[model samples]
Target chain A: MLTYFVTETNWLNFISSLVSQYRVFGLIDYEGELKWRRLNEANSHSITITKYRSIQPIKKFFFPVKEEVTAEPSAQKTILIGCKNCDLNHLKTTDSMFVGSPVSDPYYLKRRENTIIISSDCDDFRKTCFCTSMDEDPFPSKGFDINLSPTRGGFIVEIATKTAEQLISVRKHYFQDPQPILLQEREKMRKRITELVKNNNSELNWTDPQRIVSSTYNSKAWDDDIASTCVECDACRFVCGTCYCFILSETKDIWSRIRTWDSCQSAGYARVAGGGNPKNTRAKRLKNFYACKLVYRKENFGFYACTGCGRCIEVCQGKIDIRQSLAKLKKLEKNV
Target chain B: MFKSPYKSIKAELLEVIEETSNIKTFVLKPEEKFSFVTGQFVELSIPGVGEAPFTPSSSPFKTDKIDVTIMKAGYVTEALHNLKGGETLGIRGPYGRGYPVEELNKKDVLIVGGGVGMAPLRSFLLTLLEQKEKFGRIILCYGSRTPEDVVYKYLFPEWKKVKGLEIMQSVDKCPVGEWDETVGLVTCLLDKVKVDLAKTVSVVCGPPIMMKFSTTKLLDVGFKPQNIYLSMEANMSCGLGKCGHCQLGHHFICKDGPVFTYEQIKNIPEPFA
Candidate 1:
């Protein structure tokens, strides 16, 4: 519960000073949208804390899209800033996948141990946002080294872990006693974010994701509603926060085998060498995505694989909205 | 080359019989002792090649040796076909839940198998023959694409010597000179056997299509789904449950089952679908 203040005007200087002492990364403007980029002391002035989540998950930093898992590990000390609650939650899911078994993945472990994370509050919401339905707030309440709450005139920062305490000591000039007025301003921001999420509930209604999964087992709604325009490009899986399907490929015939992400949406994902695919139809494949996220992952891993990050909505080429697909599945349940 | 659930035992290949153009049977004996329950499978590996799961065709009571029958269907099996006698290879496991022997107590057993599907069931047949006095009548129905594909061809006379056991074999066609049994599908043999459905246990294994048709025929004869068991074969990279490749929904074929009763997973979508 350690609190401090950084004025809105000097927030850039505060971030710049921290960047000089630590390897820092933060959300920055990429083209027109926000994405994570390396932060240097000179460019910290341009970093934004308002975007709820980036287009790519923080996983790109932890587990790269394609990494040499078999190579000798080399991970640099780094800090990731501006991570949202949903992004942090997805990282926890990846943690177990990397660390759960005796054959722990050294590639993920090397980066995880050496990196520190600083999460900022979600001060705004997008039309596609629905973290509330997934029971996650846009803001991170815990599981962060440092928590930032944006206020009208300044930022209310709370140090969470010992790593954050070390960070605060190096930037002691930015600290000020937490004033009641600034605290009130941050509370109002939190309230507005919650209200925006609540108001957006109708757009995300899917009539209980569990029933949609069970009833759509052999439903024709998949072909009729979703499959016609699928194109099978695998964009949905790429943008998903919890899709962990990978194919371990032999690389360059020399360096060790590497696991690359594969999508159930792809035509070849489930095929064996002898050319037998249990899931062959587009309808069958689309149904698998829902089943994996809502039923199979919960039954096996005890966690809903989807964090409602809404990245899929932004990336789909067919204009397929995941929220609408679930809603349609819910409506088709009665006919089944 | 890769870690598997069972440790490698130094074993020599006693014989390799070309059962068919695409399948062969290797009879192996470990330099040391290795014992397993009937109906359990072992992981066989060839150095510099991959590993695959194969059930021992020989009865488990014969501890000094193991006989594995393999079909050259995929990567590892192709490597297994090239190995000669006295070559060193890895072996692990006798894993997965085997046949429920207790449930077969005093009950007539119907063993249905197709082509190389007889490999695992052969272990059960040999064990049942040894303990001939414990069970009711034993009936074996085996079918293959041709007479040449019918495995364990030399053991017919020995099995016939058992008083209460019946072995009915069929080939798709006799191929001119080999005409000693019925023709057409193996399900046609069900007409000749009499069974009390409530007091019978049936084990069927084969290619997915054969198993599907055999199971439907068995159910038509009033066999309970719980009493009908089937073996599932997926490309298993790791014999342990660590790898997700062998998964059928939430169940891993390597660990949860290579053998599962129809009642346990009748409703799981996709592979069972």
Candidate 2:
């Protein structure tokens, strides 16, 4: 574990230098919202290089929206910047399914192996964000090549992996040993941001998500009211950082099997042939979606499927709030 | 080099047997030999069309070729039905948990299948027949919509001749013609036969509603929940269980089971539904 201080000027120079060797992708302010974009020679100036998590999730970096699984590996070396702890935590869920299985997903494994992740600590929280409720820090504790903590005029970089150490050694001139005062300031900033997120999500109780969800399976709170608000557009699932369900379709031209993201909210998601649908009703389907995040996933994978990234809330057309829904389920749990 | 679960090996269609108007049995010879235990399924793929999971109806002992009995139910099946012999198709897996044949040794086995649900059971029956002397009495009670709808009708005569085995066929309703089998639900056939409740290991596969009713009847006839096996089918996309389509409660049908004991999944809400 090595720590370094890269001044704002040197950080920008480091980004520019890396562009020649690796495909560098970083968060940029796009019409007020942050988005992940490739930092080319032309767009390098617009790169935010901040602590904000992008609107687009990190999932697509490894598992694209649609990818031909039968194709040969591209094996492109990539550098990802400004990933928050919430998005980085989702890799654990995906890794359990795609990598930890008896049959590993070569596509995901190849991308994961080649990509260098530089996680940034969040200084602020979105109104819908609730990472604290999910027992996650605003700063990443693990699963990153390097973690960046923003401070005045520079960033305190903590290298967590051999890849990141090698990356810094290659561009060692841009980095210097951090001062004691700078390290203290970085810790204080992390604590303040964590407090803000905790205060914002105080109303939502996730102390026992599994217990609450199990008891509230038949709760009327998830009835017509919630069902009516959901248009079944599947925007939430598409935007979710940890949703790994996908449908495979083959193209006539390429003759390759392509895997694309799928949502449980879709009518045909759980429908078998001969018109058998277990989650037939909209309310039932919605319950299953929530249960997957709160209960089912924990039972299967030993962790909640949701990373508390708040992308689902931001993307939902009907303005459905997961925090509010979980609070409601908790209320129903008390009654039950 | 890591082997990907999504990668499909090429399998050439060797023969096509039209069991009924809508149902066809495809016999495929894989470029690389694909072997599977009884009651396991494979994801059959048509190049342009998509893939769907189908249990092999052929015996595991016959590794040279595999048989998949499919009805023209949806888009993938429709595309599969249009294909001719010598055409190449992609095949992945032999996935999911198969039947526990070792547990059935020296025990009377009761197999009940309805309509095209008999496909997976056919494999189980054939495998059991191969080791008939190791098992006790074997009873197969099958039901179809009509007399003409019955699959593997040609094999019934041969199946009956096996030692200590009894085959009974039933049709829900037959056309106004020469029909020689019982006319009623498969559950009705249970009344005509005496089941060794304590010793019989019953395997039931069919439409959801039929399976639900059959399990209730089997229980009423004194079969233990642990002894009854169910072939649970869900809409499966990834046979490797990465796709969440086939999730039934906490269980992934593609991984945890396509076959589960009644006692194993009985507590899960809506196990049949």
Candidate 3:
């Protein structure tokens, strides 16, 4: 790991150089919420890197909400910063789905090839954050070109790729070789934040998510308890970092086939041409979400699709907490 | 972009035959050579409309022209039904695992089809007919809503001539003096199909309910679960299995199978659904 200490001002200068060279998308605090915005020279001057993942999952950059599958999209050299571990980790699920496992999606492959990822350690986490419950760390140990940890008057920049070293540019003189004290501070910060996240999820009843989820397929909670509360606004899926289902829509003239975000919750999602819908009921649709994330994705990716980023909980219109649902599913295991 | 999987090959409409009130067979000549296995399907697209999946009714041996039997079921199919002839359409993918022809070799092959499900079975039957000496026996039991609803009527005579092949058809309720064959569900034909239960392999494709019942009957007669192949063609989008619309439990119906054995999908939740 190439570690360096750059004062907050010099870090801003380095971002300015990056913005001048390539299109930069970084998390910026907007109205008390972090939103990903393009970094211009002016915005780069005051860029505050929030370790919190944006409500939008980083998958949107690679597999867009809507894109023509056959057409070539403009692939610009880009830098994405302020990514949390949740954002970087979820890409593995999406990558395995889109990248060539016999057939590859070119639109997704092009964007994945062109962009650089800059992750940061989460010194703080939202109340709904439960990365610890999902068996993931709040801080990223890898899967990034560059990483940042905030300290008192400066940031400890740790880069893991050659591209990240080149990004330092003329501002390379600004980084001072870090002392041993800096590494000690980073270790302490990581432990404190991890403990805080674990403690937040201390009330979670289950530890083995896969076993609990697979056993709850026949649970009545989906139709009886959960379906009544859900209005099917699709907010939870939209904000989810790992939801990769999409529908192919044709343009008016049918020239371009557009792949738009699709939710399994939609009634038409599994409906056949002759109007046979396998997941016809809202209850079945609700069950499908858990089945895909907790069961299917885990089998395919060898990890749970839910990174415990809590964007689903925060953006949910029905006040449905996934943690509460998992507890309900666990209750099925007991009754059986 | 090396030939996007989504890119459609231009196919000129060569002929359109009205098979039923709502069903039509469009003979398409692809701009380039295209061939698909009997049980595999293609996404046919009208330039101004959209695409829907359909299995080729013609033989896999014929690559110069493909005969697609389409019914007016949904938006895309409605437009496909409206096409006359000589209009160009877009065709992509002969997707999914087609009928395991090799697996059926030398085994008694029983085809059970309902309504337009006969489309793909026609292709499969024709393929078997091309090499008739290889298989033990081939039986086709097809049922439609009524006499008017039955498709591919003209081919029955030609199909009946093949040695070691038997054809039995039924209509739910045919008009008086219009039909002579057995007047019952297609599953009724399974009762009369005298094949070695141990050596017979049955293929079923139909409405969800018919397939469900047919599968039960096949199991009742002691056909092995692995020998009962089912064609599940429902809710497929982006036929490459990436779009995730065609998921049945963990399996993508468009990818892992449009053709799956009962043993492969029996435990999956509502396999017939």
Candidate 4:
């Protein structure tokens, strides 16, 4: 509820100042695609507030792809920016994984404790975006330390919790009381944001989230749905926000053991040691993708693992559109 | 031993019994006494290799010693085979719900085992024998691939001498000069044992395919699905259920089970379907 603003001209400079003092991670152009990359003085000027979720999810910042969760020591501190609401929703799911009972993962705990999340509003929704259908708005709800929204001539800022207030206190002069005109601009921008989200959702109404769970279990539609083009390359899992299946490899040379990110889409993801794979077929693997996203995760963690950021669709070699697949599943269930 | 959160205790191998050509039984005695109920399993770790879940084949009554029979199917078991007496290993549990022994007291017991699956069932049988006066009748139907694959041949004769206990073993194919038991499938031996379906509880342990067929046969013989129990195995990388590797639908085969009743899991797809 504590709101403030920064001038549009000084937005990049403010980010640069934050970068100078912290190990900042900001949205950077990785070969023309927006991804969260390590930010430094040289890269801070090029960082921009993207209108859509990045190609990689926020899990990259928390649960790194190749991190040793049981490392002898642990990881380092970081501050990240330009995260959209869809990304924040996915972070809440990842929190349950690393922080599960009996013991907390030291590696994930270190990285999480040291990282500061700076969430921003989506200035534009991407073409494949369906976050609204997944109950995710472009604006963050509660978990972020600081929230940012763009205004006509500047950026509207809000601090939610003590962590954010402490961060803003580090640079008090940049803070200012809100002028009435600036307050009015934020109200108008919020309305515009809602309208944009509503329109995007209507366009995406063809794909249904509710049916993604109910129909994929034993449907013949999925046999054709997960076409021969799947290739089982596992790029979809790499790009997904909540695909947390991992394999434990013994690296006794360094440590007792290490668990690394494993993709369910891989041929051997569910294979036992003696070579029995329950989800061997592409159809079963495709079904697992839906069940893990819509059913198992919700039943276990009370949240849908998919944020509808459309990264899986963007990265699939098979061009398997998740929205289209869910729509097909809905139609198939209706026929039944 | 008293239970504590993630306690690492040292245990020594008192004896090693070769059960089959590729499987061995490591009898461990902890420096301190530890007691557990039947059907509960412990996490056995070889310092350099990794940890795996296995049930103690020894009786719960004998707290001073335990036996863990392991097949040489994976890395952990391979390391376990190389260990000798006085070698130290780490243990984590007597975790998950053990067999419903309180509910099972004073009732007839039917045990079905195949391959290395006999290990856990043996623990249940030994525990039952300690309370032999409380139970009415105990029947064991065990099967193996061939004569060379049979487990614990030394204990069969002593078990046969136990009053009111009927043990029937079978081999898929018996070799020459090594034959002395009923031949054919384990299910075929079911006809020989007289079980009053309503008064008995049956526990089955085996490979998935064998368990599936055994369940069907038990049902045909009028045993209620709820009266039957099954010990299931999965790749339990972390026995606490946080790892997600051991998930079967909503249940983690590690925590929710390595033992589950047929009625509890019949609806889950591909769970021994």
Poorly placed runs, candidate 3 (over 4 Å): A169-171
Q: What is the docking quality class of candidate 4?
A: acceptable
Query: What tens-digit string does per-residue lDDT give for candidate 4 at A4-52?
Result: 8877556667777787677888888665678777887788888767566
Model 4 lDDT, residue B187, Cα: 87
The CA lDDT at B95 in model 3 is 90
True contacts preserved, each candidate? 0.09, 0.65, 0.66, 0.29
Please give the C-alpha DockQ score of model 4: 0.35
Angstrom error of the Cα, residue B202, model 2: value is 1.8
lDDT by residue for model 2 over A1-336, one digit each (tens)? Answer: 799999988988888888988988988886668899998877776677655577788999999998888777676999998899998888888888788555778888899999999888998778878888888889988899998889988899999989899898989999999999998998899899989998988766657777877788887777755666998999988888888899988787435678889999998899987677998877888888888888888888788888888888988888788788777777777786
Show where candidate 1 strays beyond 4 Å: A1-24, A39-45, A67-78, A92-115, A158-177, A180-184, A198-201, A251-256, B1-17, B26-68, B74-110, B122-139, B155-166, B175-179, B189-201, B237-245
Q: Alpha-carbon error at A89 in model 3, in Å?
A: 1.4
lDDT score at residue B8, model 4, on the 0-100 scale: 42
**lDDT of all predictions, in order shown?**
0.75, 0.87, 0.85, 0.77
* Structural RMSD, model 2: 2.1
Ranking by TM-score: 3, 2, 4, 1
Q: Between which residue pairs do clashes occur in model 4?
A: B1-B34
Tens-place lDDT digits, model 1, residues A1-336: 788887866667777776766678988877647888889966788888766788878876766777554456778888887888888878766775565443456666778888888888887766677778777788888878888888767788889888889878877887787889888877777878878876887665664576677877788788887766787888888877676556544344332445566677877665553567777788778778877777876676776777777888788788887788887777778888
In order, how many clashes per candidate?
Answer: 2, 0, 0, 1
| Per-residue lDDT of model 1, residues B4-111, tens digit only | 222355567787877778778888876677787777677776643545678888888888778898888767788788877767666666666677776788889999
Worst 10 residues of 3 chain A by lDDT: A45-54
Residue A133 displacement in candidate 1 (angstroms): 3.5
C-alpha TM-scores of all predictions: 0.80, 0.95, 0.96, 0.88
Task: Name the candidate, 1 or 3, with the larger DockQ value.
Answer: 3
